[model samples]
Target chain A: MKRRTEVVLAGLGGQGLILIGKILGEAAAIYEGKNSVQTQSYGVASRGGFSKSEVVISSEEIAYPEVLDPDVVLTLSQQAYDLYKNKVRKDCWLIYDSDTITGEGVSDKEFGFPITTVAVELRNTRILNMIALGILVKLTGIVSVESILRSLEKNIPSQFRDVNLRAFQRGLEMS
Target chain B: MHDRIKFLQGNEACVEGALTAGASFYAGYPITPSSEIAELASIRLPAVGGVFIQMEDEIASMAALVGASMAGAKAFTATSGPGFSLMQENIGLAIMTEAPCVIINVQRSGPSTGLATKPAQADVMQARWGTHGDHAIIVLSPASVQECYELMIQAFNFAEEFRTPVIFLSDEIVGHMREKVILRDDIPIVNRKFPKVDPPEYRPYQPGEDGVPPLAYFGSDYIFHASSSMHDETGYPNNVPDNAEKVIKRLYKKIYDHRDEIIITKEYETEDAEIILVSFGASARSAREAVYILRESGYKAGLLQLNTLWPFPDEKVRQLADRAKFMVVPEMNLGQIISEVKRVVEARIPVYGVNKVNGEIITPYEILGKIKEVF
Candidate 1:
């Protein structure tokens, strides 16, 4: 298993990119007892603006908070995909929402899922981030499923917990 | 033990530290990259029977802090660039009146609201000399979320111990970044000393052996005046040349006399290092990584992370300069602290600055590239 992993979740503002990044960081830092740092950047607009959250999880202390080179890049919009697609290294895992992005010039490490469609089928489009998170855990095993579940219980409100958990479970199954 | 570990943004951690330090009053106008401090304070202060007020502007907010601190409350305010600019006048008031308070400047890019949400370290000089007149101030900067929590307690402690306004100089990147913070139950808390004299005999500005006058809170039995003018020992205006010099010199003396206690710094891998990277706030994190990469690449690079920015840590920098052949200072500003490093090194070693002002953090690789170019 990798001792350190850098993950970037990029999408339009209001897509819950930052929240998922927080969940991932909490899982590693709080639940799994590893070190982690989560830093985010977004455009001025409240919604539909460029948003990116980077999480670095490590067994040791993390020196730089921002992601220099990502081990995994997850894009939820075509704009996000376009921005980060060429920036990732050749061996990096590139995950995207197939429902919204076209997977042109695919690589073996690239994976696309109908993340929005799956969330809609789960009866809430808001859970797309959780589905993407599920795919990330299944692919990289950076953080355990149990750790993420415990982290969700702490981060998500009681009213939204059930839907989010179901979305995450479905995500684990899809990949 | 697991329950004590939590993930928190640097801004949130600062609020927790302030509350833990017994800060019972907060008044500020919310500003970007720093609103979390106010938001959390609003929720937490009232619950702890503390006071939280959203003043009309930064000027009023700073006034409220000084007023509250004088009234015996450990008070603080959080703001960004423009708001910090507005508070400069009252910061001087806090200084002149000898009211201990913490002013949190979670700095953003700015000449004037330059990039409202972006991080910058351009306020180093401003934190030192923004207010008019020559004055000594305590300015502490933190590079991580955990330090945000820990240093905030130190900020409040120094404010009370020195009886002056202490600036908690944080930048947007450090303020917004989330990381694990251990909520230690054993952190020490410091409170200002109170007057032991009778009400009639009490003189508010009369110094004890330590040069710090025991503060008398408002509504206390001590009926002494506290004014912003050049006051004598009784806290009444005495603008005589000798009296003014005495009053101002005491203010500087109270801080500088105990300079060793007020300044804190951290050295990483500098025992035999020839190349030293000096930095603070978020940029220090990058410098730390740059040191690691350089060491792995067979270069003797180390880091000197300044936890306290003001009073400039001249002696420590000078000591490090004796052993170092080259020094590099990395900052989010074009070049603020690098000048301080240069002044201390005094051309004993070649000093270089890797400055960034594009609202992006100075990455470790960028610092490494600069080291390679100069090495």
Candidate 2:
């Protein structure tokens, strides 16, 4: 059987779900030379609108552009968890923010990570997305840390490249 | 070709293909099904020393593209049904002024906002006649992600070569579907031919025997006033009936005189088949697959995939219509292109339509059912 993993990153707008999706998709498709597809959906309301970026990476050919079900579901908001908690397979891993997600007994397989707390503790609240990215990198090992850093260096602006690298490293360091 | 084949959505392939085709300017508004084109363009264009502008609306997006193309940049914009409707006035302007630019209509279900993120091929006729009144257009519909990349380059080539706006008529299926796309880095790219004539004797509307007017760059000290009104060969205002008639006639003549060069269609098993399936864009993809299934089941089914949609490939369609006893038209819309097929076929054969507007693809099975029904 082909090792295929479908990941769904759900959050409110401005949480950099799209960026994380792009980075991971590019890392798999461009670096690992695997087949990957990333798609995103957002609402009309900015900032607070429910946004989600779904990605599927596989060693074999992938079809059905949208992820019908995901192997891993990561959420940053209660709305996201509520929207997607039921859809994820029972055996799949669930990652949620303990800082924001309040719904309990949803999934005993869930791992609560205080991503916002980690970002604030790192003295840069803007790195919440990077911290999440770091967690994603460590959890899956779908892509090498070097490849993620290289993609980040190429993707982020020159002014804040070092800070984002630090944030990525910090996320990699956490658990 | 680099030996790397990657799976990509049709929208992303279009972006990469545009970059490969030397497109340096893209202006578009955010709309679903077509938003990926804009997003990819925004991220990729800047890296290639190109410019991407998110205009306030489709109108400005169309205008800015025209302006950018006039400045000698290979420009393009992507829109869907409503946005395509808003772009009609400017499309007509491009028709009149003969500006070379590409417009990608990643069509979705609509008369007006019917389904914002759904798929439809309802814009086929609109692409040809949407701009209004006696104009020539070259529209290419891509059936796969590979074609999305290949046809975009062709769209630009046709636009620049003929000095008219070329429309890449895509739909939400090919616009959003993910498939393997092999991008070529060394595809033959063409740029607009700038006039080498002296500025003093230049006529913006001057046409050779071939009906193509030489393109003059704006702000080049050439003071020709390009207008949507009737003009003389010297690009000056003219109200004379003959002058207007001559200008309009030449505009049509440029495309009509070269329809043999402009028209493109793929003939699959049409040489000796009683039943012919005529479709374009996404429907053609399903039709091709359906035809293969029919062939496997011991039925003689052929497919005519229309790559060039405008000037409407009447000859090829008529030829197929004359020989085939049954014709099936599969589209994402109800009876759009089938009407044209019916017109040219002149009821010589039984015409059937496999139509869908429910925001889902009319599957190969549906088309196969229609083929069986007609057979």
Candidate 3:
């Protein structure tokens, strides 16, 4: 197993990219029995501007929280897909929202899931992030699916916990 | 002794370290990436019968800490970026007054609020020359969460030992990252020696052979004054030529005498490398990986990581310069530590730069590509 795993999640603000990174990092550290450091970079503008969170999980201690080049890149926007596609290594797996980012450059071999479309069908746009999270867990297997679900249970606010859990389950099934 | 290795952010570790070092007072404004330090101190300090005050700004934060230190209590404050800039005026005053206090500057991207919550090590030069004049300051840059815990105690110790303000220069990444930090019970700690004599004989600026003047507490039996301006031996402001010389010389000598005990650095795989990447903070992490990757691909590369930024560790750097053919510096800033590297290299070696200012960590691939290009 690789000692270090770097994952970058990029999308517009309010897409829950940072939350997803946080969930994944916490799951790795708290559940998977590893060490992880999650750091984020968000823009000034809300909604449409780029927001990225880089999570580095390792069996050993992590010195630097910033990810240089990610081994895994998850894109939820056209801009994010374009931004990360140019930098991610060929061997690096890319998980993207098939509905927003069209067929073309990196997504040819990439895992494409229409997360937003799934959320729309479920009549909840907010859970698109959980959909993305499920796909990420299934794809990478960095943490057990059960652990991620438990992590979501602990992390999500009490007010919207039920919907988020359903969204996570739907995501896990879709992947 | 084996139980306290709990998961903690760098800021929390700093609080723990300060507590271990017997810090009784903390005063600071809340700033992102570093707010946790102040928050932790607030919760932890009062529990230990210590005082934690949230000041209006960083200037007041520094002032309060210095005042608390002079009141015969260990003191500290933590801030990032613009707040650090705000604290510079008092930082110089702390130096002038020979105040023994610790200031933790958890660095974020800046000049001013460049990125409120992101990580960057752009404050290297600011930690060194943020103040106006030529005064020696001990600044320790910790790269890991564990080091953040350990260096905070060292920051307090160094500040007390030399009766100078010490800056625990750290970055947002290290400051915010959570890791397992061992909080040991029996860690060695030091406190500044205070005056034990009759109050009338005490002069706050009177130097002993080691260049450290015995400190006096406010509200104690000792009646003395401290000035930011040049002061005579008796703690009175004087424009006399000899008095000015004595003050400056004593100030410099206090830190200069302790330089040997102050300097620290970490060298990685330099025995057979041709090009050495000199870096600190997060950049050093990437540089170490870059060296590993380059070596795996059959290239001779190494890294020289500096944990103690100021007093710049010129001798260790000079030794590295003697061995490596080319030196490369990668920083989130435009150029800060690069100039320091150049100074020690003295143009004897070809020094290259892989600079980034778009608020991103310089990666191993980016650094390795540069190493390849330069080599």
Best by TM-score: 1
Question: Evaluated on chain B only, what is the TM-score of candidate 1?
Answer: 0.98
TM-score of each: 0.98, 0.73, 0.87
lDDT by residue for model 2 (B66-165), tens: 8887777889999899999999999888878888899999998888988786688999889989988988888999987778988898888888888899
Q: DockQ (C-alpha) of model 3?
A: 0.33
- Candidate 3 ranges with C-alpha deviation above 4 Å: A1-3, A30-33, A45-48, A60-65, A86-92, A97-131, A146-170, B1-3, B6-8, B113-120, B178-180, B184-186
Q: What is the lDDT of residue B297 in candidate 1?
A: 85
Report per-candidate DockQ.
0.86, 0.11, 0.33
Give per-residue CA lDDT, model 3, range B1-375, as digits (tens). 453755567788899899999999999999887989888898999999999999999999999987898888999999999999999999999999899999998888877988776778888888888999878889998877778888888888999989999999888777776665678766679888888778888878888778998998899888888888888878888999997887888888788778888887888889888888898887887788888778888878888888888888888878888988999998888888999899989999999888887666787888878877866
- Cα lDDT tens digits, model 1, B76-111, are 999999999999999999998999999999999989
Stretches of candidate 2 off by over 4 Å are A1-175, B1-4
Cα displacement (angstroms), candidate 2, residue B186, comes to 2.9
Error of 2 at B274 (Å): 2.5
User: How high a TM-score does candidate 1 get?
Assistant: 0.98
lDDT of 1 by residue, A1-175 (tens): 5446999999989889999999999999999999999999987788887899999999898898888888999999998889887788888899999999997644458999999888888788878899999999998888999999999999999999989899889999999
B107: Cα error in model 2, Å: 0.8
